[model samples]
Target: MKNIVAVNDKKQLASFIDFPHDLYKNDSNYVPELFIAQQDMLTPGKHPFHEHSTLQLFLAYEGDQIVGRIAAIQNNNHNKINKTTEGHFGFFDCINDQETAQLLVDAAAKWLKERNMTSMIGPVNFSTNDICALLIEGFDGPPVAMMPYNAPYYQQLLENTGLAKKVDLRAYKFIAGDYNDRSLKLTEAIRERLKRNNIIIRKINMNDFWNEVVKVREVYNGAWDHNTGFVPATDKEFHYLAKDLKMIVDPDFIYVAEQNGKMVGISLSIPDINQALIKIKRGRLLPFGIFKLLWYKRKIKGLRIMALGVLDGYRKMGIEACLYGLTIKTFQEKKYDYAEASWTLEHNTMVNSAIEQINGKLYRKYRIFEKSI
Candidate 1:
């Protein structure tokens, strides 16, 4: 007999969080999210996402053993702003059985339908603001911070269950030494051109972070407004993220392009914190977890180019090249091995080529799925 239970207690929720560790035990690419972080995110009153949104976690069991888990999320802000009745299913994991996978997806779909949701999409854990896609390619290595990963078979399970490809997300890697130099030279000229236009690229003001963040928020919201499925990060989401990134943000790699002192473009690369989170033991951050995190901060090798965007009028003025140049400069000057400019929309050829111009290798790929209910 099979039973699907909604996680309501601490023990069950812990089991739900730990299920992936068991499912991917033999998989080298599988990285465990910090147990404490997952707990806080899933726990009400802990993560601000829960303040406006709702999520229900379900675990499938055959007798006393666990087979699968899923999170059915209703992002009220998403629907209210976009005026679309779409719900999301995230943290989906299941054994290699059709019945088990179906049960999990059905529970999610049914729950949203009950709430009057007309359509469904995602493996979006919280929102696109968080990691929302499934790894469909480049499964050979572990993912960096804020990226999602899953078994290849999971793709088959999702499609067989009626989910369809919404879009493909890409991650590009750059080996600092072996990288191409064409863009490196071009970046200099690009800076020269931008300088002639009163546009200058410089590091973020860490001392005035609060004031800087407001300016950044303005550019972040305006620059990517045209991208598909992009939702402005709520103040809560931004702060929650900033708090985590504070430990790893290097001002040199966090740059903004300004023209006459007005913000025009922004780029930020964070030390791949996943290196430390992988050791956090199921996302727990108590006892020795915080210690491990602090210890590994300086030793982090890779960087994730988390955000880089230029507004409409400023495109093609070398803002992108300057951003990449600064990152590469930091990598070489600091002697870091490689960096990843990731989770870009597959269709975003401009930015992809911008990174590629600097000899960035297209390493990993992630995908988002959507289906009509």
Candidate 2:
């Protein structure tokens, strides 16, 4: 008998967090998320997202055995900002049973509808700013840093649940030597031009991390403002993410374009610690798990070209090329093997085309789903 229990208390919430650990226990590609970090994000008073939006967690059980889990989210800010009453379901997991999936989603839908949301669109626990998409493709390997992963059967289960396809997001991949040598050869010229303008690329000053992040936040929010359904990350959310990434951030790959005095552009590449975490069992880091993390972190070779942004007036004039080049240059200097420039909108021709210029090939796709209530 499968029962849905609301994760209403400390015990239930802990179970909600732990369900994925058990589910992916034997899966070698699974990365154990940092427990303390997960705790802070899910805790109401601890996370800023909870101040404007809300989430309800549900765990499915078959007579004391945890079978599955889901997070029902009411993003009031999204509705208010977009003027669309769309609720979200995220943190989804299941046992590949149709009934179990249905019950979990049904409960999420019911909870959202009670809040007067007219339709449902997700797998988005909070928003796109976080790891919100389902792994519809690229499951042959472990997920990259901060990216989501799931079994391929999840697509069948979601479709069976009537969560129709909404939009597909893609991740473009590049092998170290395979990506065009043009970006490689032009690195010198690009740096020369930027240097003439007093714009140099350098690692973030870790001693001044907060002030540095504040400046980057301005550019980050401004850069992605035009993307569909993008909500500028709140201070807490951005800081939360920055804190997590800081652990793996390579100073050389975190480049800032400063001219004279003002910060104009930025590009960030994180070592794909998913390479290491893929070995972490169910995201746990305790009881001997920490050794795997401590030892294997430096062995990672893959990188994720996670962010590149320039201010509006500075979009053209080769700033994007410089940022991209600096990142690849750093990759070469550090001897990283491959990278993924990901989650580009299908309609974003400019960036997609730019990535292609560097020989990035479309290798993975993730879809965001929506349906009218």
Candidate 3:
């Protein structure tokens, strides 16, 4: 018989975080998440997310052996802003067993129901602003930084638990030196026209990082307000995320659009630190693991075009193409192998078309599943 237990203490939390390492130990494509980061993210008062939301971790076990894990999340900001009593489930991992999957799902559902939620939607760790979704396609390789990965059978297991597809998110791949340079060729002309409107595209000012982060955060929150499951991140949440990204960010890959000194658009790409993290066994970064990370980071040759956004009124002014063109130009100069622009909503045709214009091939697809309680 399987038993589901709430993770309430440090020991149980440690088990919950470490379970996936053992579950995917033999899988070549599995990249372990950092243990310390996982600890910080789950602990109350550590992550800014806990300031306004609540999450309960649950572990499924057969006697004393752990078999699966999940987090039932209640995001108050999302509910308050969207006017829906929907809950989310995330950080899911399990053996390829339908019974174990159901146990975990049931546990999460029960927790949500207790909170009076009418429906549940996830694989979303907390919200769309965080690492979310399940890898339903493109399992041939490891995930990039801040992306999710799962075994192929995960789809079947989740479906068996009565979850239906809520939406599909897309990831497009661009092989450096191979993508169409139409944007690059046209960027100069677009900039000239934008100058007529007093708009200019420029790289982020790293000298004043905090102030720059504030500007970009404004654009991010304003630009993505209409997206599926979108929620405006609090200042704490945005800065918390920015602090982490600062470590792996390439300044040249971050661009902003300004209209007479007012921020209107922003784009950011980060080095794929997962390439380094993959070599750090079990995602430890102390003792010998730190050396592995420092050594491997220099050799990382891939990038993830993590964010690109323009304020609603600023859209269609070629700012998008300029940001992408500048990024691609740097990618070629650095001689990186590939870059992935990812997790775009499947129904977002305008953004998808822009990526496609640069010859970004659709390669990976992720899905968020939902079910009524």
Candidate 1, backbone clash total: 9
TM-score winner between 1 and 3, please give it: 3
For 181-240, candidate 2 gives per-residue lDDT tens digits of: 677678779888878978776778989999999989988988888887788888887987
| Clash numbers, per candidate | 9, 2, 0
lDDT of 1 at 138: 87
**lDDT score of residue 71 within candidate 2:** 88
RMSD for each of the candidates: 1.7, 1.7, 0.8
Candidate 3 lDDT over 1-373, as tens digits, reads 8999999999999999999999999988889999999999999999999999999999999989999999999999999999999999999999999999999999999999999998999999999999999999999999999999999999999999999999999999999777899898888899899989999999999999999999998999999999989999999999989898888898988999999999999988999999999998888888899999989999999999999999988888888988898888889889999999987999999999999988999999999999999
Q: Write the per-residue lDDT of candidate 1 for residues 26-124, one digit (tens) a residue.
A: 887778887777888999999999899899999999999999999999999888878789999999999998889988999999999999898788889
Q: Is candidate 1 or candidate 3 better by lDDT?
A: 3
Stretches of candidate 1 off by over 4 Å are none
TM-scores, each model vs. reference: 0.95, 0.94, 0.99
Global lDDT of model 2:
0.84
Structure candidate 3, residue pairs in collision: none
Count of backbone collisions in candidate 2: 2
